[model samples]
Target: MTTNNGRAFTAPQLEGAVWKKSSYSGDSQGQCVEVAALTFAPFAGMRAIRDSKNPDGPALVFPESSITGFLADLADGKFGN
Candidate 1:
Protein backbone atom coordinates (compact mmCIF):
# COMPACT_ATOMS: atom_id res chain seq x y z
CA MET A 1 0.00 0.00 0.00
CA THR A 2 0.94 3.63 -0.48
CA THR A 3 1.17 6.33 2.14
CA ASN A 4 0.22 10.00 1.82
CA ASN A 5 3.80 10.61 0.64
CA GLY A 6 3.56 7.99 -2.11
CA ARG A 7 5.55 5.38 -0.23
CA ALA A 8 4.50 1.97 -1.53
CA PHE A 9 5.53 -0.34 1.31
CA THR A 10 3.62 -3.03 3.12
CA ALA A 11 2.09 -1.87 6.36
CA PRO A 12 2.66 -4.42 9.07
CA GLN A 13 -0.18 -5.71 11.19
CA LEU A 14 1.19 -4.23 14.37
CA GLU A 15 -1.58 -5.38 16.68
CA GLY A 16 1.06 -6.82 18.97
CA ALA A 17 4.31 -5.27 17.68
CA VAL A 18 6.26 -2.97 19.91
CA TRP A 19 6.20 0.73 19.05
CA LYS A 20 8.67 3.40 20.02
CA LYS A 21 8.22 7.15 20.05
CA SER A 22 10.94 9.19 18.40
CA SER A 23 13.43 10.93 20.67
CA TYR A 24 12.72 14.13 18.82
CA SER A 25 9.06 13.96 19.74
CA GLY A 26 7.99 16.39 22.41
CA ASP A 27 4.94 18.10 23.84
CA SER A 28 4.34 19.96 20.61
CA GLN A 29 0.87 18.86 19.50
CA GLY A 30 1.68 15.16 19.49
CA GLN A 31 3.38 14.72 16.14
CA CYS A 32 5.27 11.77 17.48
CA VAL A 33 5.68 8.63 15.35
CA GLU A 34 6.51 5.02 16.23
CA VAL A 35 8.34 2.15 14.55
CA ALA A 36 8.82 -1.60 14.88
CA ALA A 37 10.51 -4.29 12.84
CA LEU A 38 8.98 -7.58 11.74
CA THR A 39 10.55 -11.01 11.96
CA PHE A 40 8.97 -13.29 9.33
CA ALA A 41 8.34 -10.74 6.56
CA PRO A 42 11.78 -10.05 5.18
CA PHE A 43 10.82 -8.06 2.07
CA ALA A 44 9.84 -5.09 4.25
CA GLY A 45 13.50 -4.33 4.79
CA MET A 46 15.25 -3.32 7.99
CA ARG A 47 13.36 -0.22 9.11
CA ALA A 48 9.78 1.01 9.22
CA ILE A 49 8.17 4.10 10.73
CA ARG A 50 4.56 5.20 10.99
CA ASP A 51 2.26 7.68 12.63
CA SER A 52 1.77 6.67 16.22
CA LYS A 53 -1.82 7.77 16.43
CA ASN A 54 -2.98 5.97 13.32
CA PRO A 55 -2.10 2.34 13.75
CA ASP A 56 -3.88 1.30 10.55
CA GLY A 57 -2.65 4.17 8.42
CA PRO A 58 0.16 4.32 5.89
CA ALA A 59 3.86 3.96 6.61
CA LEU A 60 7.02 5.24 4.99
CA VAL A 61 9.65 2.60 4.24
CA PHE A 62 13.10 3.53 3.01
CA PRO A 63 15.88 1.47 1.56
CA GLU A 64 19.10 1.10 3.55
CA SER A 65 21.05 3.25 1.06
CA SER A 66 18.53 6.08 1.09
CA ILE A 67 18.31 6.00 4.88
CA THR A 68 22.10 6.16 5.11
CA GLY A 69 22.23 9.26 2.94
CA PHE A 70 19.43 10.90 4.89
CA LEU A 71 21.10 10.15 8.21
CA ALA A 72 24.41 11.45 6.92
CA ASP A 73 22.80 14.73 5.91
CA LEU A 74 21.00 14.91 9.22
CA ALA A 75 24.24 14.39 11.14
CA ASP A 76 25.83 17.18 9.11
CA GLY A 77 22.86 19.44 9.92
CA LYS A 78 22.02 19.69 6.25
CA PHE A 79 18.27 19.79 6.88
CA GLY A 80 16.50 22.89 8.07
CA ASN A 81 14.48 22.71 11.27
Candidate 2:
Protein backbone atom coordinates (compact mmCIF):
# COMPACT_ATOMS: atom_id res chain seq x y z
CA MET A 1 0.00 0.00 0.00
CA THR A 2 3.04 2.25 0.02
CA THR A 3 3.35 4.63 -2.92
CA ASN A 4 6.29 6.77 -4.00
CA ASN A 5 4.95 10.08 -2.68
CA GLY A 6 3.21 8.08 0.02
CA ARG A 7 1.04 5.01 0.26
CA ALA A 8 -1.73 5.19 -2.30
CA PHE A 9 -3.99 3.51 0.29
CA THR A 10 -6.37 2.24 -2.33
CA ALA A 11 -9.73 0.90 -1.26
CA PRO A 12 -8.83 -2.74 -1.81
CA GLN A 13 -5.67 -2.37 0.23
CA LEU A 14 -7.39 -1.11 3.35
CA GLU A 15 -8.48 -4.42 4.84
CA GLY A 16 -5.51 -4.24 7.16
CA ALA A 17 -5.92 -0.53 7.62
CA VAL A 18 -4.29 0.87 10.74
CA TRP A 19 -6.45 3.18 12.76
CA LYS A 20 -5.50 6.20 14.87
CA LYS A 21 -6.45 6.69 18.49
CA SER A 22 -9.47 8.49 19.84
CA SER A 23 -10.32 9.70 23.32
CA TYR A 24 -13.25 7.32 23.11
CA SER A 25 -10.68 4.61 22.45
CA GLY A 26 -9.31 5.17 25.95
CA ASP A 27 -6.69 2.56 26.91
CA SER A 28 -7.10 1.05 23.45
CA GLN A 29 -3.61 2.27 22.55
CA GLY A 30 -4.90 4.12 19.52
CA GLN A 31 -6.73 1.07 18.25
CA CYS A 32 -9.67 3.10 16.92
CA VAL A 33 -10.13 5.77 14.26
CA GLU A 34 -12.43 8.08 12.34
CA VAL A 35 -12.75 7.60 8.55
CA ALA A 36 -14.98 8.78 5.76
CA ALA A 37 -15.30 7.87 2.11
CA LEU A 38 -13.72 10.45 -0.13
CA THR A 39 -16.29 11.64 -2.67
CA PHE A 40 -13.98 12.86 -5.41
CA ALA A 41 -12.73 9.53 -6.72
CA PRO A 42 -13.97 6.17 -8.02
CA PHE A 43 -13.68 5.22 -4.38
CA ALA A 44 -17.22 6.42 -3.91
CA GLY A 45 -19.44 3.84 -2.16
CA MET A 46 -16.19 2.69 -0.65
CA ARG A 47 -15.22 3.56 2.91
CA ALA A 48 -11.89 5.04 3.95
CA ILE A 49 -11.79 5.26 7.69
CA ARG A 50 -8.40 5.69 9.31
CA ASP A 51 -6.66 6.79 12.46
CA SER A 52 -6.99 10.54 12.80
CA LYS A 53 -3.41 11.09 13.99
CA ASN A 54 -1.78 9.24 11.10
CA PRO A 55 -3.68 10.90 8.31
CA ASP A 56 -1.50 9.13 5.79
CA GLY A 57 -1.80 5.75 7.35
CA PRO A 58 -3.88 2.82 6.11
CA ALA A 59 -7.69 2.89 6.00
CA LEU A 60 -10.58 0.50 6.48
CA VAL A 61 -12.95 -0.11 3.57
CA PHE A 62 -15.87 -2.37 4.19
CA PRO A 63 -17.92 -3.72 1.34
CA GLU A 64 -21.64 -2.99 1.36
CA SER A 65 -22.53 -6.55 2.28
CA SER A 66 -20.01 -6.69 5.10
CA ILE A 67 -20.95 -3.30 6.41
CA THR A 68 -24.58 -4.19 6.36
CA GLY A 69 -23.89 -7.33 8.30
CA PHE A 70 -21.85 -5.42 10.81
CA LEU A 71 -24.61 -2.94 11.27
CA ALA A 72 -27.12 -5.70 11.76
CA ASP A 73 -24.87 -7.22 14.37
CA LEU A 74 -24.59 -3.89 16.07
CA ALA A 75 -28.36 -3.65 16.27
CA ASP A 76 -28.42 -7.12 17.73
CA GLY A 77 -25.44 -6.52 20.03
CA LYS A 78 -23.63 -9.51 18.60
CA PHE A 79 -20.18 -8.63 19.85
CA GLY A 80 -21.34 -7.31 23.19
CA ASN A 81 -18.63 -4.67 22.85
Candidate 3:
Protein backbone atom coordinates (compact mmCIF):
# COMPACT_ATOMS: atom_id res chain seq x y z
CA MET A 1 0.00 0.00 0.00
CA THR A 2 2.79 2.37 -0.79
CA THR A 3 2.56 5.27 -3.23
CA ASN A 4 6.02 6.75 -3.33
CA ASN A 5 6.10 7.34 -7.03
CA GLY A 6 8.01 10.41 -8.19
CA ARG A 7 5.28 12.62 -9.56
CA ALA A 8 3.68 15.97 -8.92
CA PHE A 9 0.03 16.45 -8.04
CA THR A 10 -1.98 19.56 -8.66
CA ALA A 11 -3.19 21.97 -5.98
CA PRO A 12 -6.83 21.63 -6.98
CA GLN A 13 -6.52 17.98 -6.15
CA LEU A 14 -5.50 18.98 -2.64
CA GLU A 15 -8.72 20.59 -1.64
CA GLY A 16 -9.48 20.35 2.08
CA ALA A 17 -5.80 19.79 2.75
CA VAL A 18 -4.45 21.84 5.62
CA TRP A 19 -1.47 23.75 4.25
CA LYS A 20 1.03 25.49 6.52
CA LYS A 21 3.77 28.03 5.95
CA SER A 22 7.08 28.11 7.81
CA SER A 23 7.20 30.42 10.80
CA TYR A 24 10.57 31.56 9.50
CA SER A 25 8.77 33.09 6.54
CA GLY A 26 7.24 35.64 8.93
CA ASP A 27 5.49 38.50 7.18
CA SER A 28 7.71 38.50 4.16
CA GLN A 29 4.96 39.76 1.92
CA GLY A 30 3.95 36.23 0.98
CA GLN A 31 7.22 35.30 -0.60
CA CYS A 32 7.29 31.92 1.10
CA VAL A 33 5.74 28.58 0.22
CA GLU A 34 3.36 26.39 2.19
CA VAL A 35 3.41 22.66 2.75
CA ALA A 36 0.80 20.09 3.61
CA ALA A 37 0.84 16.39 4.39
CA LEU A 38 -1.87 14.51 2.61
CA THR A 39 -3.81 12.49 5.15
CA PHE A 40 -6.52 11.08 2.96
CA ALA A 41 -6.47 7.90 0.94
CA PRO A 42 -4.85 7.74 -2.48
CA PHE A 43 -2.75 10.70 -1.47
CA ALA A 44 -1.73 9.84 2.05
CA GLY A 45 2.02 9.84 2.77
CA MET A 46 2.42 12.48 0.08
CA ARG A 47 3.45 16.10 0.59
CA ALA A 48 2.20 19.16 -1.25
CA ILE A 49 3.92 22.50 -1.68
CA ARG A 50 2.50 25.74 -3.03
CA ASP A 51 3.14 29.45 -3.08
CA SER A 52 1.63 31.34 -0.17
CA LYS A 53 0.74 34.23 -2.41
CA ASN A 54 -0.95 31.98 -4.90
CA PRO A 55 -2.95 29.52 -2.89
CA ASP A 56 -5.20 28.93 -5.83
CA GLY A 57 -2.26 28.24 -8.10
CA PRO A 58 -0.68 24.90 -8.88
CA ALA A 59 1.15 22.79 -6.33
CA LEU A 60 3.99 20.36 -6.51
CA VAL A 61 3.26 17.08 -4.78
CA PHE A 62 5.89 14.59 -3.78
CA PRO A 63 6.35 11.47 -1.71
CA GLU A 64 6.78 12.18 1.96
CA SER A 65 10.21 10.60 1.97
CA SER A 66 11.35 12.87 -0.83
CA ILE A 67 10.26 15.93 1.07
CA THR A 68 12.04 14.58 4.17
CA GLY A 69 15.27 14.21 2.23
CA PHE A 70 14.86 17.66 0.75
CA LEU A 71 14.46 19.16 4.22
CA ALA A 72 17.52 17.31 5.38
CA ASP A 73 19.51 18.68 2.48
CA LEU A 74 18.24 22.13 3.30
CA ALA A 75 19.40 21.77 6.89
CA ASP A 76 22.77 20.59 5.63
CA GLY A 77 23.03 23.75 3.52
CA LYS A 78 23.46 21.74 0.37
CA PHE A 79 22.07 24.67 -1.55
CA GLY A 80 24.35 27.13 0.24
CA ASN A 81 22.49 30.00 1.81
What TM-score fits each model?
A: 0.60, 0.50, 0.81
Which clashing pairs does model 3 show? none
Candidate 1 lDDT tens digits, 6-80: 254535443445567778887565877876653334424444578877767866655555666878999999987
Rank by lDDT (best first): 3, 1, 2
Q: Which stretches of candidate 3 lie over 4 Å from their true place?
A: 1-8
- Candidate with the greatest lDDT versus the true structure: 3
lDDT at 30 for candidate 3? 57
Residues 1-81, model 2: lDDT tens digits:
222222246445554433334457776555567656434334445545566656656655554455567779999999997
lDDT, residue 35, candidate 1: 68
Clashes of 2: 3
Global lDDT scores for all candidate models: 0.60, 0.54, 0.81
Which candidate, 2 or 3, would have the higher TM-score against the true structure? 3
Worst 10 residues of 2 by lDDT: 1-10
The TM-score measured for candidate 3 stands at 0.81
Residue 6, model 2: Cα distance from true site in angstroms: 19
Whole-model alpha-carbon lDDT for candidate 1: 0.60
Give the root-mean-square deviation of each candidate in angstroms: 4.1, 7.8, 2.7
